[model samples]
Target: MFCVDALDVAAELALPAYFFFASAASDFAIFLNMPYLYPGLPSFKDMGDTLVHSPGMRSVRAVDMPLSVQDKELDMTKTRMYQFKRIAEGRGVLVNSFDWLEPTALKALADGVCVPGRPTPRLKEIAHGLESSGHRFLWVVRSPPADPADVFQPRSEPDLDALLPEGFMERTRDRGMVLKMWAPQAEVLRHAATGAFVTHCGWNSTLEAVTAGVPMICYPMYAEQALNKVFMVEEMKIAVPLEGYEKRMVKAEEIEAKVRLAMETEEGRKLRETLATARKMASDAVGDGGSSEVAFAEFLRDLEKSSMENGGCNN
Candidate 1:
C-alpha cells in the first residue's frame, strides 16, 4: 500500500522504521533530547538580546520558530504526541544527504541513525550532449502555495515575458523558455541543455542538482535555504552564492555576473567536478546494491511482515 506520511505508515504497521532527517540539522537539534551535530553554526549573539539561545535554534522572539514548537499560548501537547508516536515506532531514520556535506552533523545523526543513500542518476549522455551544444539557460522556480496570492497569472499570459528584467527577453529570445510554474524538475535537470541552475536551495532542489551533476547559483530567500547555501557553497563546493543585494532583492547584473562565474571560472570547474562525484555517489546509493535502495527494501519487507502478523491484509 502507498503511504503518504512516513510517520503514519510506521505507526499503522507498528514496525521499526526511520526518517531521513532533512533540512537544517540545527532545527532538529533544538529539541531537548536531541544533540546538535554541527558545532560551527553561527551564534545568535548577532541577533540581539531578546532571542533565546538554544542548541539548534536561536530566536529573539518566540514567534520566530513554528508556532506549534515554540513555547506559546497554544497547547501543542496533542501535536507533539502525534509527532512522537511517529518517531517512536520508526526502526531508524535516513537523511537525504552525504557525510561530506555535513560530516559532524551527519555523524551525530548517525550515532543512533541510519543514513540511507541518496538516489541520483548519472546522465552522461545528457551531459555530453549539453556540452556540445552551446546554450545558456535560466531556471524559473516555484513552490506549492502556502498562502493565496491576490493576483493569479496563468503560465501562458501574453505579457509574461515583458515583466522580467529589461533585455532578458531579447537576450534569451533564441535560447530561453519561460515555464510559468512547476516544470518536470528532474527531467529538466537531466536534460542535455541545462547549463546552470538558479535555485532557492530547498533541500530537494539542492539534492536534485547534486544528483544531476549540475552547478548552482544560489539565491536563498527563506527558511533553511540560507543554511543549505552554507553547505552547498562552503562545504560541498558545488555552488556559488549570488551577492550584491541590499534587502535580498537580487538585481539582473548580480545574477548575470554570478551566472557567468558559475559557467566560466576555476571555482565553477571545481564545483562541476564535485557535482560529478556527488552524482556518482548518489547513483551508487540508489543502485541495486546501494545503501538507500537496500534499506528501502528492508523497510518494505518489515512493513509487509508486520502487517500480515497483525491480521492486516494488503488488497
Candidate 2:
C-alpha cells in the first residue's frame, strides 16, 4: 500500500495506483487474510516450534509462515497486516507467477502440487539411495556455492573434493558427472538424460523442475522456501522431503534415502507422471496464449495506462 501522504498526492494529481506482490499467491493470501486469522491463532505463540496448519492454505504449517504474519505483537507485523488489507484498494494486482502453479489460490483467491502414497517405494531414492537399493542413475554433482549461507555451508571454502565424501568421485565416475562449474540448467532439464532433481524448492528451481517434468527431493532452507516445500510436498504432492531435516541441513543417510526415493521406487514412477502433467501445464502457461503471457500483457496495460493518466509522474 502507498503511504497516506502519497495517496493524497495521487488523488490530487488524479493518478491511478496499483500494488505488485513478489511472493507466491499463497503468501499474499495469507498476508491479506492475517487480520481475520490473527485473533483465532492467538495460541500460536504457545505452540512453540510445533507444526500448525495455516488458515489460508491446506497442509501449510505455522512454521512455514513469514514472521510478518506470526508476530502479532511486533510493530512490523501490525504494519504488514495493515498494508496487506489495503491490497484490494489498488487499481489491480499483478503477481509475478503463473496460474498453473497456484491455481486454487489464484482462482478461489488460494495454491496446491505431488508425490505418492505410502504403499510404493518412491523414486527408489537418489543416485546413492538407488545404489543402496540396487538401482542405477546418471547424477550431476554441482559445486557448492561460494557463499552458501544455509545448511551444508562448507567450512573455510573447501574444494569440491573436500566437500564430498572421500572416493565418491572415483566411485561414481563412470555412472555420474561431477560438474564443479556451472551447468546449463535449462539445457540439462530439457535433456532426456535428466530425470529427478533434488532441489532446495526455490520458486525458480521449482518452476524449472515443473517445466522439465522432473520430480524433486525437497530440501528447503531460509525464508518462504519452507512454504514452497510444504506446497510441493503436501498440497501439490509432486515432491518428497527428507524426514527430520526439512528445516535443517541433512546428513549422509537422509540424503541417500531421498536419492533412492527419486531413482527407484513406485512412488517415484507416480511422481514422474504428475511432473509430466505439471510440465505441460507450466509450458502452456508460458506459451503465446498462456497464463503468464496474458498476465504480463495485463500488467503492461495497467502500467501503460497509469503512465498515460499520470503523465509519467516523476518521483
Candidate 3:
C-alpha cells in the first residue's frame, strides 16, 4: 500500500498489488473518482463556497479538496491523477480507518462508492499567543524556508533571538520550553502531562493524538491537512480549528483564545472526555472481533482466494 508507483513493477512481475491508502477513507473516495470529476473545471481556488459532492462524503466545499487534486493544469495535479488511475488498476485498496471511527465514510465504501509545511508565521505570533494564554507549553521551533522552492528543504537550526519577539523567551521562560527542529512527537503525545496538541493535522500525528486520548487545536499547513482539519473539527468533534490558519498567518489573539478554549474551559473538558472514549474505541477497533480486526480478516480471506484463483501467485 505504500508503493503506488510500484504497481507497474508488480504487473511486470505478474504479482498482484494493493494500495494502502494512508489518509482518511473520505479522501480516498475523492481520489478514486478525480479523473471524472476534474476534467473541465476552474481551479478549486477559484470556486469559492461551491460544494463538491463525492460518493463517500457529504458535499465538501470545492476549495477544501486536497490541494494536489484541486488544480487541473499543474503538473502535480496531473501526476496525482495518474496515480489515482494506477490505484484504480490495483487489486484492492485498504484504508487506515475503522468503521466505528468513520462509519459514514466506511459505509459508503461498502456500498461501492469509489471502488478505489509550515511557514514560520511570523514566529512572534505563536510566541505571544503562548505567553498570553498563560499556559505551560513545549514548542518545537524550526527556521522558515527561505523561499517557496525551499519549502521541502531541510533547514538549519533557528536563531531564536532573531526570529522570536524580543523578551518573549524571558517572559515565558518559567512556563514554556522550546526545542529546536524535531522532538519525540509520539513520546510527547503519550505523556500524561500533554494536554492538547497544536498540530498541522498530518495523518500520523492525528492518529498519535487520538491514540493518546489527547484533543487537538488544528492548524493545517499544507497538502490534504486542511481536509483533515475539516473532518476532525466538523465531523469527528475531536478538535477545534485554529482560526486564521487557512490564511497562513494566525494572530496571537486567535491563538490565545483557542488555547484557553482547549485548556481552561468547560468545552475543553468535554473535548478531553470525548477523546478518552475515542481512545478506547480506537483500541477496541484493532482488538478481537472489533471493526478493524474483522475487516482485516475479510481482506486476508479475499487476498488468499484471489491468490489461489491466480494459480499460487501472491496477490
lDDT of 2 by residue, 172-280 (tens): 6666665543567767777887777767677777877788898998766555676777778876778998665433545546767777777778998989999888888
On the 0 to 100 scale, the lDDT of residue 242 in model 1 is 67
Candidate 3 at residue 235, lDDT? 80
Q: TM-score of every model?
A: 0.62, 0.72, 0.91
Best by lDDT: 3
User: Against the unseen true structure, what C-alpha lDDT does each candidate score?
Assistant: 0.54, 0.64, 0.81
Per-residue error for 66 in candidate 3, Å, reads 2.8
Question: Which candidate comes out best when scored by TM-score?
Answer: 3
Candidate 3 C-alpha RMSD relative to the actual structure: 4.3
Q: Ranking under lDDT, best-scoring first?
A: 3, 2, 1
Clashes of each: 12, 26, 1
Put down candidate 3 lDDT per residue, 1-315, tens digits, no spaces: 335789879778766788888888767766676666777567787896688776667677776777666677889888887887667778778888866567777777667666430004557898899899999999999999978444688788999999899998888889999999999999999999999899989888998899899999988877788888877887888999887775678999989999999999999999999899889999999889888889889889988887787677552
TM-score (C-alpha, index-matched) for candidate 3 = 0.91
Residue 117: error of model 2 in Å?
39
